[model samples]
Target: MRLRFLAFLLLASGFGLSSASQEDSPRIGDPYFHSSGAWGQDFRDQWAFDAIGLSDPYVVWDALGESPSPVIVAVIDTGIDWNHLDLSWGSLWTNDNEIIGNGIDDDGNGYVDDRIGWDFLAGTNQPWDYDGHGTFTSGLIAAEVNNGIGMTGLNPYARIMVLKAVNNFGRTRTAYVTDAIRYAVDNGARVINLSLGGPSALELETAALDYAAQNDVLVVVAAGNEGQDLADYAFVNHPAVITVAAIGRNGERSTYSNWGPQVSIAAPGEDILSLRARATDTLMNITDAYKPGSAIVGPDKRYYRATGTSFAAPFVTGGASLLWSRNPSLTANQVRQALLQSAKDIGASGVDQFTGHGALDIGAAFAADPNASIVAEISSVHVVQSTDGPAAEIIGTATSDRLEIYRVEIGQGETPSSWKPVAQGRSSVTNAALATVSASEFAGASVWTIRLIVNRTGGTSQVTLYRLSLG
Candidate 1:
């Protein structure tokens, strides 16, 4: 129960935010485009792309042949545009068990006949994006790529599951937010993105996040747009969520973006304009100069572009989806750790309030070895007190195909004897479950050396050993 509670706390705390007023300023020029092309036309060639060195973290074009489709990412914000060309392929999870309108709770998770996704704001099945915020956010995360249409998304191949927590007015009640979170977790969302937040903190919201993490769901949230330190506010201080800050094309922190020690990583936020519905396919650049009334009309016939930390959160969420899609075995903690470790350090050396770890380096994260061992290899083995217990767990692998545990004699001040088999089993090549060995056999041996023996079979496998003490 305690472990479960800790897990819940970890998950809830991971949902990341803050809010601030927008000030008018000069618009920064496009950092990615050359003189011959509009940044919008050739944005992929921008320095931001070169600095991060990633082309659509979600596409995985090079890895398509080797990996399976990525996991589903749940966007809990304003509703997404179901008909947007870039996002049509990346809509929410369909409840195939339930019929569209006959009014039956077929799947029985509480909501009724939710064929598409839930709308916590309206408290119904209608989760259409009236404000276009959710649509833009979704587009950044999983909009389809190489369709010869609009802009490519971070994780184009990843599925986008929408959960409308915020209303058309961009306001969400805490209770509704909590319900939406639980719904996402129970329904099979691996990555949950929260782009909306409030000044008030609720225990229910925290608990919902906790539940999601315990269930193996990753929660990515925006560091508040208010440039204030997050340590000063309880609403944004949760530890379970991976809080993200907004950075600009110059690799500098967005002036309007929030800062705090809780921030995990920074991503491109300033001047980012995504697909919004309007008469023509037009883009609205959000910048320091972005005023409250500025809007653009696209084919979908909607207008938007009020920038905040709210927009920055999805990039990280989308990037996580891409990473998780490639490596489904990665836990939420492991994913968070990878993002932090792989980030390009900014502000100060090590972590600080301004930028957390640094700007997120999607290329570094995508290129990382997901199955790398967390434990160090045993060079020299020493048994300090091997009283009355089984032999120490010999952690090794017969090969990439099998995990093998062994029991070996360890003489004091002498070379360890030959390895003797203890337990062996076949797990996923990337072990979803770990191997465990008991230490009851070496009950009274005072001195012994524990050595791990490996037998190469199909491929080289990494093994981890743990010393268990029995009183």
Candidate 2:
């Protein structure tokens, strides 16, 4: 089954289909069948949720009182169903300053009257989810949770900012996507989800991504569904973006998920059924829907089954938004590092081509203390080394005007027991500062560690280890 899916993806790419066709596009249909219960067994299994274990790390949930609200995440895809029940909670903000029917640039952001979001394809603000692809993607990221209907998104409280770059016909141009990205960054979008990709790389897209990085916006892109190495394509080679691969229930790489050093992490994308449009012009439940046997005849009289890494990419994007919203001070690079570091290692001891750092562990990420201090202050230390070797510098600051003393030591390991004193420093004023001995003291192959011991001499004075630099 996986091999056939990969083959299909390869063929789709050859024909210029980015990932999968738009949900509204005409395609194969499944025979109408009725299920006796709620969709699939996987839907009711709490253990299945446990298997994914997607919970926030950094303890942002507890600190923020509620999940981050009104955090804008731009879904740079086809378009979103503005009326989708699951997505109504955190819908895009309309620019009230601009008249919907007027042909004026109210906000003056280049696009005219982009009340909700700009449609680069149509060159308008009416970015409706015509093809249903963006709606599904948005649902994965910020679909309303605990709404007593449909599925819960990773960050249900996050706002879904729609930036339509692809058209209803599943045709997208590189220039459109690039413009969408720039608009997303300029419009206060903290995260940008890119589920569409092609075999060709564009210089404009690269510049747009670079601009996003410079502005501290996190860009989450699919690692492609071709089951091939992304290193072979320059389009997915952006280091500032988090490239997501797809993983199956068995904790293995999805057969259609591309693999390579460029792949940053994996998410559950196999047999996952997200919200899809029914033939009757209503929503349908298609959980655990995979290819071949996973098709369903919607009320609209169309066959639909959700599959591909395209769906998985939004999960990461939504997760990132939740994390960023909770901690607005965190830079985009820091958020990417945190997500990658928190992933559960699957394929190897370190990062691998297939899974990168492994599947995302949201639960672990939410449970861990992101701001917990790992460094402590003592005194400055010095060691002997060659003149050309790397130098070590440690600086200290006094927190109060009263005298503040500190003890310093050099250690062979991370623990204090492995440490030995080499130098010491003391401060008598609040503005006092100190630095470790010169680089000539510690050189060669010896691995030395520095520690600082702070003491209050007068009043309630405090001390800090300000700087630590090693060349």
Candidate 3:
């Protein structure tokens, strides 16, 4: 199968800067729209961070205090500009096992002198981003934070393991990705971000996903940019993968984002500003590369703006890294559950086709109880759209050995303080309908909240919240 980088090029801007080899290397900072007070003094173009409850990461950081252990996130794409100014030495992964430049496979891992990362296409050590896709994805996951630099990544503690699987033209073969997946897992990667996808599913790639899961490595993939239901897409629906969809800044699914039952979560993907690989003309030749403004390269030639599910996957990869950094004992499935449970639910009543469990919530994921499965829980809740009317059926699992009653309630607003019960005093059922919510009930309100109250046999209880939206 032929895989492609799942992105829609929009804009590329930068003040022509010299190469990294130069003595007086140029300094890169936030975008002009951000730093010049064009949007606002405090505003920056990285709205995805805030959308996922990462505006202030101190909630997770303050608890860890000082240095958080770095989690290796493998970016399998068109390589990365490892020398990007905003990406420091500390942010990228280094392979201590492989000795560099001696012309021998010191580590005996099949590759010679693979110190930093391997380039599968060239079969060399230098995995430079000739197409700029991997560099952009890497920045979203592990760009240096709070040095007054370009952009802030979701996880400051993410050490990017640059794996070049795709070529300059943004295409990769099945064998390349399959090998990259194994290499990443063997090289100590906790999370693998696959920002590329294809139409057909190959056996090798299918096994690769299983290999990652077997090794307890989390795989996050982009739900391709085709904007169609991915029910027939076998690659994304794989049990081991957490497929991510792209949503705009307004919290609605992006027009180009593919959707299906397989969609694990959604993240901000429209006009997302990130690092641009030097000497790469990814968006330069595009038809409307500068729709909002004319091409102006300036103060920061390092920034690139684009949209797609490709950009959205890293936000989740970064979030997974943060969770691992906080508590290394978290299983890949546990981390996946934490992400789903802590997500800021949007669209439909619950785990809908568009947003899945909901949007990525890094802050909540960090604070989420890692051992949540042991207690009374609400595994999932989703809207079953009715064929008859505006009313939809709410169905999901709320089960535990110590369960007593589970109540479903609805309230107005994003985070409602008051909730009125819609379905109450019901016994636990493995897979059964909970309640029915009509659009007419909450007239004039577009946003509402669905509260799942799981009261155990004892006084102990567990409360879970899901966001509901209607036209």
Candidate 1 lDDT, 251-326, residue by residue in tens: 8787766665467778877556566742322222223433333344223333223345666677778778767767
Clashes of each: 34, 26, 4
Better of 1 and 3 by TM-score: 3
Every candidate's lDDT: 0.56, 0.58, 0.74
Top candidate when judged by lDDT against the true structure: 3
Ranking by TM-score: 3, 1, 2
TM-score of each: 0.66, 0.65, 0.76
- How many collisions between residues are there in candidate 3? 4
Runs of candidate 1 exceeding 4 Å displacement = 1-51, 56-59, 232-235, 278-306, 369-471
Per-model RMSD to reference = 13.5, 12.4, 7.6
* Number of clashing residue pairs, candidate 2: 26
Q: Using TM-score as the measure, which candidate wins?
A: 3
Q: What is the lDDT of residue 216 in candidate 3?
A: 98
Residue lDDT tens for model 3, 152-203: 6667788889899999988888788889999999999999999988765657
For candidate 1, give the lDDT of residue 353. Answer: 54
